[model samples]
Target: MELAVFLLRLLVGILAFPVYLLHFLGFWSNICKKLFPPSMVVFSAIYNHQTSSKKREHFTNLQKFAGPSGKLSLLELGCGTGANFKFYPPGCRVTCVDPNPNFEKFLIKSVAESRHLQFERFVVAPGEDMHQVADGSVDVVVTTTVLCSVKDQEQVIKEVRRVLRPGGAFCFWEHVIAKPSTWTYFWQQVFHPLWFLLFGGCNLTRESWKTIEQAGFSQLQLQHVQTSPILGLVRPHIIGYAVK
Candidate 1:
C-alpha cells in the first residue's frame, strides 16, 4: 500500500511539471507580475540578489560612454523596483519611468539605500511613450532586461533616441531569442504560448537588438552572451551602447 501511494504521488508531481515550469521560469520574473502588491517585496529581493554580479557588470558598462558622472542627466526606462540604483554613479540626476505603480514603495526603499544617486521624480508611464521627457534633453538612457517585455520595441527605441542629447548614449542589457539548435531554444519556442500567458506578455522570442539597430542609432557597440540562469528561454543576453 505504501509503495502504491508513493508511485501515485510521484505521478502527480510529474504531471504538474509543465505547469510549474510555465509559471516559475526565468527566475520568477513573470511570476512576480502575477503576485500581490505587497508580497512582491520577497520576490524582488530574490531577483535583485540572484542576478546581482552579472547585472552589476552590465550597470558598470552604462558609465563607460557616459562621459562625466557629475551633472549628468540619466533616464531609465522600465526602472523596475530601482534594481539598478546602487550601480548608478553619484552626483548624477536620475529619472525613472515604469508602468507598474506598485513598484513605488520598492523604489523608495532602494532610493534610500542608493545614497550616491540623486533621487529625481518617478514618472508613471510606459517607455514606448515618454512625452513628459522633452527631446534632446537627456545625457544618457539606460535599461536592463526591459526590451524583451515591452509592447512595441520599435517605439521604445525611437523614444530612447528622441530624448537623448546629440551625443548622448543609450545603454541596455536584455535577453534575446536563442538559436534553433539548442535544447533550451527548442523549449523557448515550444512553450512560448504558455510562457507569455503565465508571464504577462513577456515574449522569449523577440529580436530586440535588431529593432534597436534599425532605429537609426549612429553607432552600435553591442555584444551577445549566453548566461546560465536556470531558465534557458531568458539566458542568452545582449549588452552594449547605441549612440545618437
Candidate 2:
C-alpha cells in the first residue's frame, strides 16, 4: 500500500510539474491574462444559456436604479471580457475595472460589440483598491464571480460601497463554498490550491456571501442557488443586490 501510494504521488507530481514551473517563472500570470478573456467569452455564452432565467431575474433589479434620463452610471469590478455588458439596460454608462491590463484589448472589443452601453473607461485596478473611481459617483456597482478571486474580499466590498452613491445598489453573483457536509465541499478543498494557481487566484472554497453580508449595506437581498451542474465544485452560487 505504501509503495502504491508513493507511485501515485510521484505520477501526480510529474504531471503537475509543468504547471508549477510556469507559475514559478511568472509566465503563468501573463499566459492566463491573455488566454482567460477568450475562454471566459465561450464560458459566458454557455453559462448564460444555462442560467438565463436566473440572470434575467437578478438583472431586472438594475432597472430600479435608472435616473430621470433612464440611464444608470455603472461600475463593474473585475470586469473580465465585459461578460455582463449585455445584461445592462440600454444607454447605461459603464466603467470597467480589472487588475489585468491585458484584458483591456478584449474588453474594448466587447465594448464595441455592445452598442447599447456607453463605455466610460477601463481602469486597470484591482477590486481591493479602485482609487481611480470617485467615491459616491456611480449609481450601481456590479460584480459577478469576482469576489472569490480578489485578494481581500472585505476591502473590495468597502470599495464597492465607497464608489456607490447614497442609496445606490451593489449587485453581485458569485460562486461560493458549499455546505460543510457535502461531497462538493470536500472536492473544493482538495482542488483549491491547484485551482488558485491555475485560474487567476480563484478560491473554490471562499465564503464570499459572508463578506458581503457583514459589509453593513443599508439593505440587502440575497439568495443562494445552484447553477449549471457542469460547474462542479463551483455550482453553488449567491446572487443579490444591496443598497448602500
Candidate 3:
C-alpha cells in the first residue's frame, strides 16, 4: 500500500507539471473559454450587477476603497478570460496579465467587440515577474480567484506593491482556509493531489490573503461570506481591498 501510494503521488506530480506548463502557455484557458462561454458570461454578469444584494454590497465596499475611475490604471493578475474587464469602471485603462497565452487570446475575443473599454495591454506572463510593467504605474490591482494557483505568492505580492503607486488600491476575491468541518479539509487534502494534476497547479490550501497582508498592503477592508462549508473547502468566496 505504501509503495502504491508513493507511486500514485509521483504520477500526480509529474502530470501536474505539464498542466502547469500548458496553462502557463495559455492552452487550457482558451479551451475552457470555448467549452463554457455561457458560464463565463453569466459569472461576469453576476459580479457586474450591483442590484444583486451580494454584488451590491461588494460594489459599495469597492467604491469606498477605489473612489473614482478617471485616469485609473488597472491591473488584473491571473485574469482568466478577462471576464472582470466589463465590471470595472469604464474609462480606466485596464491591463490584464496571465501566464496563459490562451487566456490572453480569450480576453481579446471577449473584449474585441466592446468599444467602450480601453486597455493598455494584454500580458501573457505571471504577475510575480512583471519586468514588462513599469514601477508605480498602476492605480488599482485586482485578483479574482487567481491566488490559489500562483506558484510564488510572496513574490507576486511584492511585484504588485512595486507596480502600484502609493495609496493605490488592491482588490481580491479568493478562497481560504475554513473550519467547522474536518471533512472538507480531508477531501481537499485527498483530492488536491489529483486536482492539481488535472487542472494546473491549483492547490486547495493556499492562504493567499494572509500572504497579501504580509506583503505590505495596509488600510485593509475585508468581508467574509460563510457559504456551504463544503464549497468553502475549495471556494471560500472572500472579498476585500488593501491599499498600497
Candidate 4:
C-alpha cells in the first residue's frame, strides 16, 4: 500500500507540472503590470532605436507649443505605468488619462522620480471620455501605440482636439495596418481575435494614420515607416505630429 501511494503521488506531480507553470507565468505577468506594464516595456524596447529619429523630430516640433512660462501642458492619453516619463521634456506638466487604476501606483512613483515633470492629475477614465479636461487647454497631446487598442479611435481623436489649445501639436508613434495580402497582414488578422486578450487590447490592423488625418487637425504631417526591429506583423508604423 505504501509503495502504491508513493507511485500515485509521483504521477500526480508530473500531471500538475504544466498547471503550476502556467499559474506561475500568470502571476508574474500581473506582477510585471505593477512594476511596469508589459506592453510599454516590451514594445518600447523593440521599437526604441527605430523610433529614435522620429521621436526627436516630433518632440522638437512640439517644443514650439510651450507657453511663455517655458512649460508645456502635456496631456497623455493611455499613459501606461508612466513608461513615458523619461522621454518627456523638462517642465512638462502632465495630465495622464487611462482606464486602468492598477497603473496609479507605478505612475505616482515615476512622477516622483521625474523631477522634470509635474503631475497635474491622473484621471481614471478611458481616452474616449475625458470630460474632465477643459477645451483648448493643453499645449501638447501625446499618444504612443495607443489608438490601436482604444475602443473608439474616432472619439479619442476628437477628445484630443477638443482638449488641445489652438496651435497645440499632437505627437504620435503607432503601428498601423500593414499592406493587404502581405504575409504580415495575414497573420495579423489570424491573431486579431486573441491579440487584445493577451496584450492589453492592442490591435495590429488599425488604419491609424487615416484616422488621425480625419480628426479635423489643421495640419497633419506623417511618415509611414517600415522597421525590421520587431516582428513583421507589428513593424509597420506611422510616426509624426499633427497641429490643432
- Write one digit per residue (lDDT tens) for candidate 2, span 110-217: 898999989999999998899999999899999999989999999999999999999899999999999886878766766666678768889998888889889999
Clashes of 1: 0
Which order, best to worst by TM-score? 2, 1, 4, 3
Q: What's the candidate order when arranged by decreasing lDDT?
A: 2, 4, 1, 3
Q: RMSD, each candidate, Å?
A: 7.3, 3.0, 5.6, 9.5
How does candidate 2 score on lDDT? 0.86
The segments of candidate 2 whose C-alpha lies over 4 angstroms from its true place after superposition are: 1-14
Number of the top-ranking candidate, with TM-score as the measure: 2
Which of candidates 2 and 3 reaches a greater TM-score? 2
- Measured with C-alpha atoms, the lDDT of residue 218 in candidate 1 is 89
Task: Please give each candidate's TM-score.
Answer: 0.80, 0.91, 0.74, 0.79
Worst 10 residues of 2 by lDDT: 1-10
Candidate of highest lDDT: 2
| lDDT of candidate 3 over 144-237, digit per residue (tens) | 7678878888888888889888888788877665543565555565457666545456677676667866776768877765544334456455
lDDT of each: 0.77, 0.86, 0.68, 0.78
State in Å the error of residue 87, model 4: 1.7
Error of 4 at 76 (Å): 0.5
